[model samples]
Target: MRVLVQRVRSASVTVDGEVVGEIRPATQGLLALVGVTHEDDATKARRMAEKLWQLRILDDERSASDVSAPILVVSQFTLYANTDKGRRPSWNAAAPGPVAEPLVTEFTDALTALGATVQTGVFGADMQVHLVNDGPVTVLLEL
Candidate 1:
């Protein structure tokens, strides 16, 4: 599993012009673009969730674990896109929808189980994500 974690002041997801999920931080929050590969399982999903919670990116020397900041998760298989060889990116590293959807759900559920206030984008849907990226702080997480 891989995630692009971005600190955000606020974030939202829209599908077909309807807002699906939205979050505004009291302080700071995270917008997670999550990806699932063929090898990713519940264990990897769980570990990544835990790591995101503990990551010390927030101010006041606090972690999301410390403040219980909200998280907005979006399924983003495109994270695995490989473009080294050609103009058309190869998606071979990404798991197809049937294989990936459940893992994405599991990842979000695991984060919720860990007490995160988790919001999500619709899996397999065309989504528009909007965010005010705090600090422009972005990090790639993998497990």
Candidate 2:
């Protein structure tokens, strides 16, 4: 499992012109782009959530856990794009929807269990994500 974490002041995910989830935080929050691959399981998903919540990339080096930040989660299988060969990227490394969707849920569930307010995008849907980045901070966590 991989999570691309970005610190943001506010973020939202829209699907089919309808806003599905959003968070406009007073302080910095996170937009978590999650990807699942073969061999990834619930444990890895949970671990990834823990790491994301504890990551110290927010203002003054404070973690999301320290400030009770909100999180906007989005499924992003393209994170596994393999471009080692030709121009067209290969999705072979990404887990199929059937195998990935539940794990992504596990990740979100884990984050909620950790006491963070969370929002999410529709899985497998064409989404438009909007955000105002904070400090332009971005981090990737793979487990």
C-alpha lDDT of residue 78 in model 2: 96
User: Model 1 — which ten-residue stretch has the worst lDDT?
Assistant: 56-65
Predicted structure with the largest lDDT when compared to the true one:
2
Q: Write the per-residue lDDT of candidate 1 for residues 1-143, one digit (tens) a residue.
A: 99999999999999999999988998899999999999988888888999999998888767788999999999999999999996999999999999889888888888999899999999989999999999989999998
The lDDT, on a scale of 0 to 1, for candidate 2 is 0.95
Candidate 1: where is the Cα deviation over 4 Å? Answer: none
Candidate 2: list runs displaced more than 4 Å: none
Q: Highest TM-score among the candidates is held by which one?
A: 2
Write one digit per residue (lDDT tens) for candidate 2, span 26-123.
98899999999999999999999899989999988899999999999999999999999989999999999999999999999999999999999999
Q: What TM-score quantifies how close candidate 2 is to the native fold?
A: 0.98
Q: What is the lDDT of residue 124 in candidate 1?
A: 88
Residue 141 displacement (Å), model 1: 0.3
- Estimated TM-score for each candidate: 0.97, 0.98
